[model samples]
Target: MIPLGGAAGRVAGLVLAAGAGRRYGGPKAPVFLGPALRVLRDGGCDPIIAVLGAGARRTRAVVDLAGVQVVDNPGWAEGMASSLRLGLSTAARLPEVSAVCVHLVDMPGVSALAVARLLAQAHASCLTRACYDGEPGHPVVLGRDHWAEIIETTRGDQGARAYLRRHAGHVTAVECGDVAGGYDIDER
Candidate 1:
């Protein structure tokens, strides 16, 4: 199903949808990039958890399509770091989730296949990041080992970028040959 090696192990799809979207003045996750797409609709990357804040209700409603799990971030307004912490904390508890692909909901072009590939690559290589477009993007395939560190840094604006930089040695870049892989549309 997930394309990972050997046993299924545990892997998670962690969607970050908690931003305030100050510029767009609304929730970005709900933007209908393409609800009809087959890859996102049928890929079956489940336990699809979405971290929601700011416009939590709206985001929940939009991404909740077909029953996706939504986790509330109490300190989400603090920044992406808090949201990341909330997500990783929840992901750490899933028994089948040995790895996590941190996703940005508004990265509309990201497909479930890319996510599966990253998840598989993480297990095969035992690494912590799945880069795209020559740069690190969403769906960062974090191995089971990095859960502790990700959960601990839950304050201010501290984010995964710093850690990604520190652990650059274990990163793997999977180019989808698409700019959408590197694009970040934050209500703009």
Candidate 2:
């Protein structure tokens, strides 16, 4: 794990793969977990954490989660918020992890380059994310300073939307459409 970050900090990768993916016919985590993990690893996140829900058993059976910390979210059916809280709570235990780059499993177009660009300027207090042609996208880099509030405000499938919107002015948007696409897959 690379414990390196700009201005002295460690950024952990948080993969939210707990969704049931009903529209996609099944859980997308088992199918795309590997690629998502590679994205964070190659991008520069250390001590990655992947939260599995719906197909937890199947995902674990087929996916290779050797180095990454696999977190099973029993309340995953509640929503993405549960996975986010669980992942962030796990990250909070690591004193070395100063921030987390949150990525979604359904977003296959999101590349390591996009994650790299976001992590390039990450720190303990920086709120950054990838923007595709001025539109906000995934791979949101959340600083440790804002975790408590995010965990409190997020509910259901909202994730960190409430917190991000509340502090939009402080969030830094990094244009990554040049290197990757931000489109998420919803159907088979």
Candidate 3:
């Protein structure tokens, strides 16, 4: 259980694990869900939300859904945007959540330490993204102020790429390559 209230404010974690893993042969959820949840929990994120779609039943059967809130994205087949929208919307409803840290299940290289770094560098009114060797990547932190806009602009699998690009000036990039890798295991 995460302690409530800190200088950094209360931040919820949103894990996007609803993908069908069409290229990975089977559901990536069974492989990544547990570790992902552990990373978020250990990183001090409260009320972590894991969005499930493809193989939801199989994932539930294999993964331990203990402390996290599992939200099923029925429209997940549409793409990542639906999951993102579900996560952001759910986070917004929590009065204690001032920001959200979004993580992808496929990126197992991302560590709890890197998530801690992102949370530590997060600003109340600015966007923060983990950087690998100076290149922006996930676990992206988005302040409540940007949630609505992000939900509005996010589409398909692009996620917040366009919105972040347009508001690059307001983003805070934290270097975490030494501690974690932001590689996506989409194939094989």
Candidate 4:
């Protein structure tokens, strides 16, 4: 367990890495897991949790997940929602986690700076997302208060888009264009 935060807040990094990466020809988790973990760790997120499915076994064999909590999602083939649900559930179980900064395994361009920017704004009810040039992107910070609703609303590959859209008035968009690119790797 991570040390509880004093006044700022404690945020956990949840990496959605269960996809089989059909477009990229294989699981990107094995190739990019380390970078994802590094981004989260360097950004100040504690008690990180990585959810794996498709290549869970291979990813475990190739990736060094020391000090990081790993969760295996058996329903990954259904879509990214499964991974998000599993990751969120795991985060909710961590008593010290006030918020979760979600990162994608295939998004190599997302840097620690972006994650830090988002995490800096974390609060018990804050809903923040990293946006590049006004474009909403990864490393979305969902406070613990909203975990249950997000888990209930997210479906398929939509992730938390639907919830964010519905609550745009409450969501904070942190500009990270200077620190990271929002593009995700979809092909070789």
Candidate 5:
């Protein structure tokens, strides 16, 4: 497992933009969400690495966020696991990152403060997740120490579900009084 605070001792944001978006018919990463770039970026987090796959270039083309790095995941077509792995691996390498808060492009409404709160709560209680009002949601925060544990069970688009399912006991349900936690554009 990646030891807590073993890296640069700060959090790095991982924006999962590598999906093929078969239903959306194009790259969803470049899809604009208000004034912010399609790739999620927020306070207290280091640079965001927009993991790209399928239409890597096309999705990244429209993102105008400065200092945002784009990393291609060859395994993206294989599934979401590859993108997760690629993102986590990149987070592991950053000199200033000790944790990763995963944000999905489709869920653009999740606040940066919500993510920070989860991380803070986890560090205090040794928790791994802050479920959004009893239901799990995006922007799952993982301490550096949990990296190795997650990397082992992760393989594809399962995203963080595998890790969350196995460690359900470590999850803390949180109520943020916000709809972003419950909102998902793709949900029908």
Candidate 6:
């Protein structure tokens, strides 16, 4: 079991909110950003980063983004990988950040409890992902050691799927279905 408190290391929260939401008809940021940030904050993550694109202006206008470190991703249309890279890059610059817990704005069902579980299990050398009913899902915790490889292999909308699959053996899947729903709000 991972040790508690100070020895656990620092984990930054990265919310990928830059999606175009083509199918959902508008920006998801207005609907999901607040709760996502709250979950990360309440779950023990510091310096949360929210990547904005597509409807950034409107998102900023509608959402009450108080404590988050907002970063605009001009290449967001390229897809999730771009936002992921942006968030990771921003987090990596902070010397205190040892890992990042990635969350998607569209997934409002991912609770603070699930995020806490993921953060609680985090390790500087391990890639921990939240799973729903044994199926791997989001709020993925990626150690600093894996960021470079993930940033290199990720493309299009796949995010870190390719890199995770390539190093599946190193991942520790934690069951979070009981605490959170791993569903994406992709459609209206």
lDDT of each: 0.64, 0.90, 0.87, 0.89, 0.64, 0.87
- The whole-model C-alpha lDDT of candidate 5 against the native structure comes to 0.64
TM-score list, all predictions: 0.82, 0.96, 0.94, 0.95, 0.81, 0.94
Candidate 3 lDDT, 77-130, residue by residue in tens: 989988999999998889878788899999999988888877775545769899
- The residue-by-residue lDDT of candidate 1 on 10-116, one tens digit each, is 56667777777777777676663233122333434456667777777765455434555678887887888888888878877787777766776667667666665
Q: Give the per-residue lDDT digits (tens) of candidate 4, residues 4-110.
A: 33315688999999999999999999999999999999888998999999989999998999999999998999899889999999988888888999999999999
5 versus 6: better lDDT goes to: 6
Candidate 6 lDDT (Cα, 0 to 1): 0.87
**Cα misplacement distance, residue 99 of candidate 5 (Å):** 0.9
> Alpha-carbon error at 114 in model 5, in Å?
2.0
Between the candidate structures 2 and 5, which one is better when assessed by lDDT? Answer: 2
- Tell me which residue pairs clash in candidate 6: none
Candidate 5 per-residue C-alpha lDDT over 1-188 given as tens digits, one digit per residue, 9 for 90 to 100: 12223223566667777776777776676673322333234435566676777766765565565777678887788788788888888887875666776777777567655665655544312334445666667667776777776777787578878777778787666555363454655632
| CA RMSD of all predictions | 3.2, 1.6, 1.9, 2.5, 4.9, 2.5
- lDDT-wise, the better of 1 and 3 is 3
Off by over 4 Å in 5: 1-8, 32-40, 122-127
Candidate 2 lDDT at 97 equals 89
Q: List the candidate 6 regions with Cα displacement exceeding 4 Å.
A: 1-7
Q: Model 3 off-target regions past 4 Å?
A: 1-7
Tens-digit per-residue lDDT, 1-188, candidate 2: 23234524778999999999999999999899999999999888888999999999999999899999999999999999999999999999999988999999988898888888888778889899899999998989999999998887789998998889989999999999999999998899
- Report the candidate with higher TM-score, 5 versus 6: 6
